[model samples]
Target: YLVGGGQNHSNISGGGGQNHSNISGGGGSEPHVQGYKSQNKFLNKEILELTILLRNAESRERSLEVKYVALEAKLCQVESKYLVLLQDLKSPVCSSSEQSPAREVISRLLEDALDNTDPAEHAVFKPHPVSEYDVFGFRTVPEEDDEEEKLVAKVRALDLRSLSLTDPEVSVGVKWENYLSSTMNRDMVHCPELKALMRSGVPHVHRSKVWRWCISYHTRMFRDNLAPNYYETLLGVARDKPNPASKQIELDLLRTLPNNKHYSSPGADGIQKLRNVLLAFSWRNPDIGYCQGLNRLAAIALLYLDQEDAFWCLITIVEVFMPQDYYTKTLLGSQVDQRVFKDLLSEKLPRLHAHFDLYKVDSSLITFNWFLVLFVDSVNSDLLFKIWDAFLYEGPKIIFRFALALFKYKEEEFLKLQDSMAIFKYLRYFTITILDWRKLMSIAFVDMNPFPLRQIQNRRTFHLEKVRLELTELEAIRQTFLRERDTHTDAGPLCSDDEEDN
Candidate 1:
């Protein structure tokens, strides 16, 4: 959060419209110069001291995080042991081969938790069950087959050099496993090595666990406040009581990721899981209830996580990760983000922003879904998960960083285009061709350094107010129109009667 303090201070005078001439009006030039120098020295010293304090605090935070994760890990072990003990007490004499029940059960549970499958293998297109369908489950058009083939080939060719035993990531990968055996700590992102690993990508085998860990940490407070078996409770309630959002949920189930095998068929397991999760969430958060974008979020989570895990991840994303009302009927928070993003675009990629303005194109047209669904279908699955790895770790700022990086990545090309239509077309489809996940991440995290969370929060606050006011004015206008229509309707018959009498 302190990453951008100095930069923010430099922009203070520019941001403020106050005149500086008044400061020197009463004082002589010599005194003013001396005073300025003294103040500058004091400010610099203060900044240095504050920076040191923040760094120390950050270190302490990391230590506490490690401890918290360790404790959680121990708790899990205890729970596993308790379950084993209970089983032992209830069981009769078992086979000699199953002597170490605790170890055997724990090993199986660990294996289930940490899937060792090749991530790329999941992305390979499967042959359609029927002649009309293509691999990955979507019904195929001849035109789309070429594009799908290229994406599949890119997935197959994804680099795995970072996973080698000799690589630094391998060592950090061990730390990641240990870190996740318990709860997640927000400060863990401060670790340079872990941060790099997450930014590069969580290994496919560990991705689900890491995502669960991060989300669990984020929603820890909310989870703690809820009763035990909250998800199950919510599920039961949803089954007993009809949710108003159930129809919408059912409609969206088939619409979500039809191309994926899990969601391709009407009776697919993924479709059922998606339905249950969305229904459960609608019951869980009635305020926002069910939103269209959430279906995609849950669908993506279900790709790696099971039903319960995906549900919690969706909760964290909608309730904790994003701002409130982001997916509400009005979607005020989502609209506010679009406004904030446009400002960020202007600040971070002024040329591209200017190009967008010159073409009379609102950037939000291309970016609304990007932010709404967190770029699910915009990027390939491999890269989508990579983006999400950092997103879950770092927070929403990752979205802005990646958004800016996209425009910056293709800035020159975008500028080369003559008209808005071509630009729009490129913006729409450019992300699908992003084969270099590492470069995209590097551009987001490294090149876009000091993209602080505090700044984004402030921008959101500012835009939220603006959007609220705009909504209010629109409402007022609508009210005035309604009143005028009512008055005209009431007077229309009387006017005709008076004309007939005359």
Candidate 2:
């Protein structure tokens, strides 16, 4: 009817009829209204199409970033192999004793070359030529903090020779490099010397290779049992599927290492690589999904590993090295470790532990992240890497040693601070400002000697059961409260039935 009326009004408007001019004017505007609606629909369609295009472009860009990172890692591996060959050629053929120093000098030169090259030169994650970030790709503290500055300067000025526990006569370093280079690698049990060498520290040039070898040595069973291209397959599955952890992973990508130059910007390649590593792991282990501390593990791994290698390194750490539920929602494993840590603290550092207990200080508050992230942000990068060198080679027991060492190293200073808050605040920055890595490591290994791995395992088992029982009791209490609340709701108000009847 409206269409018919409009047609009649249109005829009247064209006939110049003054009596129906208002109707004629309304009809005359009808086409303009229709045109505007059509235009709006077209624009909406265009917007929808463009939005999809933009999303597709972003997906492609991420894919390219992952590909680029993988390729870069392969290139680095090739370069490393080539450099090893070159160094082998340069070394003099002589008696083992005479060749030792030559091999050391050659390896040192190779390390310098590898360190000097800017792998991320064309990449977005290149570190700036400034003091904002340390050589380890961690951000430096503000200059206003004189104490932090002084400590950082001390660490920077530390002679490299002082860092090594082994002397020239000790053949640990030489034997370690040889074992790492050999095809038929022996287990840590067979090569006990590697432990002493690792405790001293893996050489900077061979650190990455050493980590790969150590992780592979430990996780060989897990890695070998996997199908070919398992990591890549995980990545493909993650890319195609919408994971429950993807959103949380996205939120944490930039937050993972924002201070580091590699992850400074949102669009940095490190961010993408981190995202892929986490996302792939989430897909690989849906039960664990993505957890808070995994990012730190993966980020640090990335500094010395490529994207795929980093992903597998994470798997090795989370699934193989750590106990079950360490990164679960409850973090029950972490809590259990903390409980065990407190127990060890009391036994090892009795005075400090007694002091903490007297002050009502919960030691776990200061040390939980240390356990969760393996002291990533708690300590300076250089020392942290040294700790990791031992950690990957020695297993989680290294964490307990280091944790005890930190408190032991600062026991005197800690005893002076009577206030709990002051102690907590001080402990936070003290590890980062450690003047000497060697002293800290010594305190961990030598000072905390006879630190039995078996004891840690036994304690962990005891705490795991205790934590489970506590959680069960808490759940039962919650259920009882919920049941009572439901009963009360079902019974209604005391006066409600009578009032309704009335």
Candidate 3:
């Protein structure tokens, strides 16, 4: 959720539109100048009072959130203890002589319950459904490797002084900031100067601004939405309406960015903010409402953006950078893109692809989340920021370029690890391995290999047709199922109680 980097537009007439005539209108110039002054004073006072009330409510919300967390922990403890007691009851550990009749009755009833219950319900040891896409589902590192926390140690021990701001980078920051301001202030252009600077990386303090410019958030905000109060309006409408996707959104929010201080704990302001923005988006685009990896993308955007801006930037990615089909029930576009990536990797790096095949490693295992979340947790956070700087500038090709580049750089390590778990460890805990981000960018953008966008687009065209054909097949199957169901229903009770037909 975002939205606040003001620009001057003479027509905005009060944010310029039919939308806020009442708020911005001053009621016909000089004829009622004295009346206008009085009205302005009264309205200003009311606005000041409302602002204070809003602040107070937010403070109270913060306290309530803290209390909710404490209560939730106690609730979980009680539930766990109850489950253990239930387990003991299932085994009938205590003799009837030692306990009361009521207790014995409870135990006996519990035993009956366990006997009737599904085994899968308590099968905590059961493995997850294996997918080439799900690596975080497994415990990757071996006990010996984890004993030393070797990855953590390596990351901590590595010196990254070269990443510190240099004279040239600082100069670029100044130049980019001016570009950002001009862009925000509606001075839009195809600035080669700005795009070149963006490839280097954006400063932390100015990332939100840089991102705003990249997405043309200001332009979209005014042009497409047309309503200056668009974010606020959707927020109000969302609150009043019950969301079908609310439960899934809640679950994902709790698990997202658990280590990042901003989103570490549930019910924190950051969590609430993430929830609101995601829910608003769910409401904004019901067709693609609440996909799993979207929370990670929104969380990062929310960190850099205001509430509404985050929402719109997410839209930009899905509509512009990403194929709309990627986030839907079919996931046709994402799968096609995955195939495109795999083929491209084979085309560009035969040795690496062969190593992957030899180990029975699916390319999707590493690349899925890397692409889905735009490398949110896949790479080092600082490095992810660098990638985002380029991603927003260069478009989705940077993603493919970065993925291929990582494979190329880690070709040796990947070859050494013959097992899936070890390769998965290499992929999942990658950010923990110390990397020179500036160097990685250099390789991804320039040094490692060439990955032409036109070639990728050609692959994409073929994949899209394949997916559409699959979609057609799926729809036919669905229609066949419906016909069969209807026929079965009609054919039922051929011999009725009142009149039987032989």
lDDT of each: 0.73, 0.75, 0.68
Candidates sorted by TM-score, best first: 2, 1, 3
- Candidate 3 achieves a global lDDT of 0.68
Error of 3 at 368 (Å): 0.9
Worst lDDT run of 10 residues, candidate 2, spans 121-130
Model 3 ranges with Cα > 4 A deviation: 1-147, 150-158, 161-188, 217-222, 419-421, 448-450, 471-502
Worst 10-residue lDDT window, candidate 3: 126-135
Per-residue alpha-carbon lDDT of candidate 1 for residues 422-472, written as tens digits (9 for 90 to 100): 888888888765655657777887787778889999999999999999999
Locate the minimum summed-lDDT window of 10 residues in model 1: 157-166
What are the models' TM-scores?
0.65, 0.67, 0.62
Top-TM-score structure, candidate number: 2
Cα TM-score of candidate 1: 0.65
* Candidate 3 colliding pairs: 1-306, 1-307, 1-308, 2-306, 2-307, 2-308, 2-309, 3-309, 12-16
Candidate 3 lDDT by residue in tens digits, 17-52: 343453358544443454446546655666687789
lDDT of 2 by residue, 93-212 (tens): 323566576666654544443333464543322211224466676665443545434333423323222232223313556766676666355444435667777887776677887788
Flag the better candidate by TM-score, 1 or 2: 2
